[model samples]
Target: MQIPFIDLKTQYETYKEEINKEVLNVLSSTQFIMGPQVTKLEENLAKYTGAKYAFACSSGTDSLLLALMAIDVQPGDEIITTPFTFIATAETIALLKAKPVFVDIDEATYNIDPKLIEAKITPKTKAIMPVSLYGQTADMDAINAIAKKHNLVVIEDACQSFGAEYKGKKSCNLSTIGCTSFFPSKPLGCYGDGGAVFCNDDALGAKLKSLLNHGQGKRYEHKYIGINGRLDALQAAILNVKMNHFEAECKKRIEVGSRYSKLLEGANVITPTIMSDRNSMYAQYSIRVKNREAMIQKLNDAGVPTAVHYPIPLHLQEALSYLGYKKGDFPISEQIGTEIMSLPMSPFLTESQQDFIVNAIKA
Candidate 1:
């Protein structure tokens, strides 16, 4: 039997009618741009995440960029972030001509070590952008306390942790500004690229809205330089339908992740550690193994598909070499990058499928 990683097709089959009807409604209305659905989605997202406001953007990259622009990140400014996250987290800072100040990650959570943040901050440090890697939130309270002491902004890269919670609050609403992706493989995804920015600061929220719409405060009025970052109405409509069932889906994801850990216990794998203060959405269900490549090959031979959420940390990438980072700069990130591997994961995965995957790993 063949196992699939992230069974989107099966999920679509389950929700075909609801998803198809929403797409058809968009086509029928022909309001393909900023239609009513977009506003409705933003409202629903804000309510769901408990963020005072939410602004949809074209992609997760744009969501990060818009957050930086809204917070007035300037050239030569520095933004502190983990080196282990996806490049977009640091790429946006570099795009603004601001510097990305790399910090090491905690071993357990694989998130930026808040204790090390103080040493990285300088007068030019403008923000702290911690990623909630693999669906669990960083220690946001500790990160926030440091940011508060330094008077810096905090932009949470919540792309992989949209439905996850931290200390009773949602991931997106736990920081000064939060960004999340709606890529096809994400927990709550659309047919194509999409993302959203969330904020509790009213002024920053309004600024983010303007920045997403070509800096227009009103029609034909350019308030500040911005990008065309608006989310498509079609994507918005699709997301609204997903929102109806997202809570239940998230709960199921937690259950699935727990089962994976329980089954893998005492095996030659290091299962993901979910902090007691928070719950994960289990976006990838990554496991750490010394011989990742061999394990991947063995799993593939058994018809079990696997993937690496990130094979290389951002600091070592060719795109960011100008940052002058060397391999030894972040030993933990480099080491983990070599060992982390993702298994088949989704709310729709069945008990038999999970058993098959686990047995393949053990064998």
Candidate 2:
């Protein structure tokens, strides 16, 4: 049996009618830029996340860029983040001609080690950006405390963790500024690229709204430098439809993830771990293995597809070489860069398909 890594087909089958109707409504209206749908989505998202405001954007990358712009990120300013995350986490910092201070990740959770954060802070450190890698939030309480002590802004890169919770709080609500992606494969995704920024600070929220629109607080009046980062109206309408079933889908994702952990107990792989006080939305049920490449090859041969969450650490990427980071800088992230592999995970994955995947890996 061929087991797809993510069963988008099954998910679509469940929400076909609603999604189609929403898409058609957008096509018919043709108010295709930032319209009523985007406005409604922002309101709903803010309420759902318990944030004072939410700003929709073209993509998660744009959300981060806009967040940095709102905070006046300048050249030579330092933004500390984990080396184990997607390039966007570091790229956004670098794009503003700022410095990205690489922090090592915790071996168990594969997230930034907060204990190591204080030692990296300096007067030039403008912000601390911690990524919620693989749908599990990093230790936000600890990270926030450190940020407070150093007077640094905190931006939670919640791209893979929109519905996830840490302690009793949601992912985006725990930080000064939170950003999430709506890439097609994400847990809370639209058909195309989309993203949102979350913040409880009213002033910051208003500033973010302006920053995403070329710093225009009012039409034809530009206040500060910004970008054309508005979310597509069609994408917003699509997301609104998706949100109607989001809570239910998140519950199903939890159940599906639990089942995978239970069934893969004896398999030759290191299953993901959940922090005691946290809950993951399981954006991608990733695992660490002895020989990831060989396991990938075996799974491929058996028609059970698998993928790596990331193959290289951001600090080591050629684009960031000017940052002068060497291979041994972050031992844990480098180790993870070599072994982490993601399995099929979605709200609609069937037990039979999951079993086929597990059996293939075990065999």
Identify the leading candidate in terms of TM-score.
1
lDDT of 1 by residue, 1-363 (tens): 867799889888988899899999999999998979999999999999988999989999999999999989999999999999888999999999999999999999899999899999999999999999999999999999998998999999999999999989998999899999999889999989999999988899889999999999999999999999999999999999999989989999999999999999988999999999999998889999999999999999999999997889989999999999998999999999999999999999999999999999999
Minimum summed lDDT over a 10-residue window in model 2 is located at 2-11
Model 1 residue runs over 4 Å out of place are: none
Across 43-158, the per-residue lDDT of candidate 2 in tens digits comes to 99998999999999999999889888888999999999998989999999999999999999999898899999999998999999999999999999999999998899999999
Error of 2 at 227 (Å): 0.7
TM-score of each: 0.99, 0.98
Cα misplacement distance, residue 248 of candidate 1 (Å): 1.0
Residue 75's lDDT in candidate 1: 95
lDDT of 2 at 153: 93
Question: In lDDT terms, how accurate is model 1?
Answer: 0.93
